[model samples]
Target chain A: MNEIPQIELTGITRVYGKGEIAVRALDGIDLTVAAGEFIAIMGPSGSGKSTAMNVIGCLDSPTSGHYRFNGVEVGRLSQDQRALLRRHYLGFVFQGYNLLPRASALHNVELPLIYKGLGRAERHNAAHEALRKVGLDNRAHHDPSELSGGQQQRVAIARALVGSPQVMLADEPTGNLDTKRSIEIMEVLQDLNRSDGLTIVMVTHEEDMAEYAQRRIWMVDGRIERDERTRKAA
Target chain B: MLWETFRLAIQAIFRNAMRSFLTVLGIVIGVAAVISMVTVGQGSTQQVTADVEKLGTNVVMVLPGQDTMQGGPGGTADPMFTLRINDAVEDQIASVALSAPISQSRARVIFGNENRRTDIVGTDNRYFEAARWDLNRGRFFELSELQSGKAVCVIGETVRESLFGFADPVGETVRIKTLSCEVVGLLKSKGASTFGSDQDDFVILPIKTFHRRIAGNTDVSTLFVSVRDGASIERTMEEITALMRDLRRIGRGEEDDFEVVDMEQFATMLSGITDILTGLLSAVAAVSLLVGGIGIMNIMLVSVTERTREIGIRLAIGAQARQVLLQFLVEAIVLSLIGGLIGIALGLALAVLGANWLSIPFTPDPGIIMLAFGFSALVGVVFGFFPARRAARLDPIEALRHE
Candidate 1:
């Protein structure tokens, strides 16, 4: 299908430190993702897969790059502007499920909406809806510590989806889960992609987890070693 | 957004309730110390003023020697420098409504077995008028007694209680030194004087009797002059000085042997001393407020470091850097504000208790209260900024990765 790309990156190079101690975290990477696509990035430790996720999530800016999101150059935006971009256009789920330890599941899910300056009633309703989407509406009052690993990840996914963002960025969504819980999480991602037409970019080290996405990208050292479309799950 | 941030800040503070309370303890003590110190100081100043004012603003004292002479002339005391303010000089000052020539000597007065060594003042009927002393029992000595130099005396309330055991001493005879004097009157209790000496601890006798007996000298050591109502005290003092200078035959530029002191000026000087003392005490107490600010800063810095992960999550969820800064800053301010409020209550209670125990007036100064509260709030802002800035500038990725 002919469509404008949702995200485009060219010559993305991110280096840490300087001179003899400098390490290149990202090396001249070029990538493109269309709307409604689910992609997985796989790499070894220190292979820059997380760095790529950060840059794609707008949590970090590349040292030098021409990165575009919906035809707007994201690298040139101010820090606050980038924050606004993340606020309205992107959602992020970390491997650690970084929900506030003291906040309840509902409050955690409503965090992005709170940043968006939504009304209290609107935020409550939207958070309730998001919790229902993850099938955890009954546990909306439970704290993160009270929830299982799979339930916490679902809560994180609900937080990411609460904003109805243009793209979902998940960094090792199933990193801390068992095989059954991981499968459940993968099924939720597959359902969102297939039915809701939501775009997702995920980072994982497991080959089986990577198989869940429609496209798998393998990275070596800071560069993309291979990118190819894979068969959809049965 | 501010409300949400405020709620988050409160939650964060309450999460470590003990730490937050301990952090604010410094502010509590600082505010309480400053408030109580100033309050009690003001109360003492008021007490002094009230006591001095009770001595009568229109009254002035004409003591022997120059005004600088303390303790009735120093070692090798010269009789020439010691003023002989006799009855003749009192009659010469026309600006005074009345004047009393007074002499004093230390003597033991014995009635029965109860005897106390106390000051024995020698004056006339005019002494009661000039000193504004009212009689509580019996009658003042008659002009006839003063002129005939009778051995009758008036006992003060303290002497009456000490020598008579609450019984009237008017008709009783008390032995003063070597002479037996009849107590013709009882003076009212004047409580304590401004300088903290007991005003009701002495007995008064006719000056003629004192000159013939106890002191054995005709020298009047003091002159109590009462200016007429609507009469200018400064002008009267000048007139008294000129008359004394003329009577003493001291030419111009030759220092007079006597001094005239207006009670008003003395009262001002005493109050001024209290003000200076209060200022010094308040300054010393203010230092604790600064120490309190440092305590808040230390706790805030710890909170910022400990909550680094939470800050990162907030930033990642699209919180502006300034919003995060405001959150922590407001938290610190709330802590100090609450502490300041509690301290004010405690300080006022303490001040009232202290004033009661010390028998001084409890003076609550609103200006100091507002100033103390404002200073505590400022302390929070001043000390909380750096930690908030550090939290705001933290890199989201690194913060989220913080263990």
Candidate 2:
């Protein structure tokens, strides 16, 4: 495709501390992802895969580099401007399923829309549609504690999709799930990517989970060691 | 957005209801103490003012002692000096409307078979005029009767009830100590004074009759001097002080042996003392408010720490730092406002109960209630700022990584 990539990074570096004890989490690197692509990033514990995801999600700034989200340089933007960008275009899912424990599944799905300043009726309708897309419409009233691990992950996916973001960044989406639950989450994410043409960047160590993506990028020691295509682009 | 923040805050506060209530308990106690103390103090001051008004503000009491508060010259002066002071005030001072020498003692009075111990006052007819007392029936003492030192007396309502039991005692003969005195008049009823002493429990007789028969000595304890209406009490007091000093042979640079106590000044002094006490107590109570604010700050800090992950989640979900700060701040304000409302109710309740117990008027000041409410809100803002800012300034990555 000749269209401009949705995300572009050039020479990104992230250092954690000061001179002597400083740890460089991500060394100089460059990568780009086009619209509607499903990509998975994989590495061992200290390989800086999570830091790369954080930079892509606008949750952390690079030490010295350019991060272009939709071709707009994100590194130069203020903290509030970046937050607005995140609100309007990006969604994230964490390993812990980070849904507010006290809130119901529907409310968790409605969280992003609330930050988007949507009206109550619009938020409810959109949240319901997102939940139905994740095959969790019947479990909308249940709290996170009441839902199974796979169900909770589905609710989080619904929350990410409710904002109608251009990209979804999921860190260890199936890290806490059993084999069956992991497959269930991976199938829901695959179906979303193929049917809705949603772009996703997932960080995971599981090879089976990475197979759900069309392309896989492997990180090692703060740099990308390999990038390979497992399937043709949808 | 603000409404959403408020709703979130309320939900968080309700999540740990017991802890929230305990956090605001200090504010409740502090506000309650301040409000109740001031309310009761105001009520007492009002009562004192009303009592002094009843005694007639123009009346000045001349006692046979120096200013008692200063621990100055103690004990009564010479008995003849009191009479001389009264006579000098009556004859020399043009501002003096009426001056009467009064000698008092407690004595038992008997009528038929009923006898009771009551106060006996010895004075002339000018005493009734100076005291603004009225005769309910019969008449006051004639000039000849006072001059001849006749054993004629006027009975107060309390004595009349004790001795005659609602019977007309105007012409009844009652024995006072060892002398048999005829009741020439009946005094009207005057209720309890400021000190809760019964004002209608005394019998009045001529000073001469009291000096010759009951006391066996011409000793006048005090002089009641009433200033003329529209005359300056300060000027009249200065003149009386000058005349009394001249008559008592007290020289310059020496304190007078007698004290001229203006009823108005006494009332003012009483109210001033209560006001000072109330202010001191309120200051102490306000310290507790400061402590309450600190308590709120401590709890807010703890809450921020405990909710670190939640803040991270909110931040990651595109919530602005200002929005997170606003959430915590609203929670603190709502908590303290709840405490303030409870304190107001408790304080007003205590004030009413205290007023009834102390027999003072219940006076709840609306201005104080408003001040307390506004102060609590201010406390919430001031103390909640640090914790809220800390929460806002948190690094989302580090916060999310927190266990």
Candidate 3:
């Protein structure tokens, strides 16, 4: 099979500050992501998971690394290039839900497509399709503040999915939800991975939450501690 | 894309409408004050020129005893001494149109029911044309009356007004010192001089009458000479110089004891001083625009700080660094442009009001209006740079993290 990994990171290291005060946020990390793999990163706080997410999301630069995304070299890309990557190839859902409080859920979902230069009607259709996938089509016109926590998260997920990105990175996608809502969100993520063939990378501290992914990677002190794969249910 | 950015800029301004208006008020008032002050200064100059032209076009004024004047380089004050001779000036001058001997004194006058103060001028009929005057009610004194030293006088309009109000003082007798003279004619109106001196508060009589009845002497204080029509003033001035030297009985190398003035050159000389005043006023007013520019800079800086999050959102949503910079810069430019437009309106309105107050014509220069507006836009660009650069250089990640 000649299909290469959709994303790859090799010997990646990030340094901050200078001399004695300097610290490494990521150390000698290597990883590969298949086109449709659903992977979870489990780590304690400040284990560089969020920092790695920033690098993977193209919002930041890694101090030292050879990072490849979708078979293209990404480490040397310019700011504009990374913005293009974020626009065309990657989607993001952060723990804060990050939906603008004043914007309606429909506007929030259409925002990514708007930046992609889609027409208004096309953007509306895509946003509605994504919102329907997340089971929040009825909440599309509600502001983030007017919606419940689970609904807001679904709107955020819809925003991520609206662009039809190759990868969706969810950082603690269910961190702010109760047990029932958390399962519902995980079910949505699982359905996307199973039915849509979208590569999913989730960051979580909960073992039960990470167990839902096909593969798990553990991190500590800015370094990878373990890698494990869960067996398919018989 | 530019249209979208423009819409966003306008929207941002309207989002805090009152704050934006208050911020631009400094620029508005500053520009308006600048326009009004300059227009007022120019209006006064134009009014003065019109009034001076009424005296006589291309006329030159000469004065006697230059050594008797005391002031700074450009200071204007009354000369301390008077010319003592007029005989030489009467004969030697060439291309002469009219020449009149004049002497003056401050006098107290008494009429039928009024007492007033006036300048007592002793001159001939030639003084009328030289000074651009016409009789208001009767003919000028007859040549027989002029040569015979008759005790007759012509009063200026202001003198008539002060002594008679709406009544006709002509054909009536008034007393100056001990002489009782009939007002044979009244002079037409001549408004105030640039220095606010009353050009109409004067009495005109033949030089012969003034010398015999008032001064008890043959000496004349000054000579008012009018050159031939279309004659080069310099030629007549040279002739007057030779005439004065001969009439005063001075030797070839000795300076005559009198002076002659060309009214045209005198008007230019006076205008030169006012031009300097106008230039200085404009310079001081220009500083207000500069201060207005600084006000824009301060407000833009505050705006950049206030809109940090919005900038981050824009950048994240695909705005280039230059795009962010352009957005802020255009916001400032739009603000200053609006200010300039409003300032022009307010300034022109004030200029019209000022014209009425000063009793002059209302005129607004289109060039000055364009200049004021252009200056405001230039201020926006020059002063808004730092704030725009600050916004463009902000880290999007840090901005996203910022509240």
Number of the top candidate by lDDT?
Answer: 2
Summarize candidate 1's per-residue lDDT along B158-204 as a digit string, tens digits: 88889899687889999998889999999888776656677899988
Q: What tens-digit string does per-residue lDDT give for candidate 2 at B1-403?
A: 7777778878888998999989999899889888999999999899888877767889998887643334546744343445666787899999999899999889999999999899889999999988878999999999999999999999889888888997999888999888999999998887666566788999899999998988888888788998999999999999999988888888899877788899998889989998999999999989998999899999999999999998898888898888888989998998888888888888999999998887778999999999999989998899999999999999888889887
Q: Candidate 1's residue-wise lDDT over A1-234, tens digit each? A: 667799999999899999999999999899999999999999899889999999988889999988999878997777777788888988888889999897899999999999899989999999999889889999999999999999999999999899999899999999999999999999998888888889999999998888899899888889999998877553
| CA shift of B164, model 2, Å | 12
TM-score on alpha carbons, each prediction: 0.86, 0.85, 0.76
* Between candidates 1 and 3, the TM-score winner: 1
Better of 2 and 3 by TM-score: 2
Across A26-98, the per-residue lDDT of candidate 2 in tens digits comes to 9886889999889999999999999999999999989999998888899777778778888889888899998
**Interface CA RMSD, all predictions:** 0.9, 0.8, 2.5
Native contact fraction per model: 0.54, 0.54, 0.15
Every model's DockQ, to 2 decimals? 0.61, 0.63, 0.25
Q: Which candidate order results from sorting by DockQ in descending order?
A: 2, 1, 3
Give stretches of model 3 more than 4 Å off.
A4-6, A33-42, A88-218, A224-234, B14-41, B44-52, B66-92, B100-125, B133-192, B198-222, B281-295, B339-369
Ranking by lDDT: 2, 1, 3
Which ranges in model 2 have alpha carbons more than 4 Å from their true place?
A: A232-234, B67-77, B80-92, B107-218, B242-257
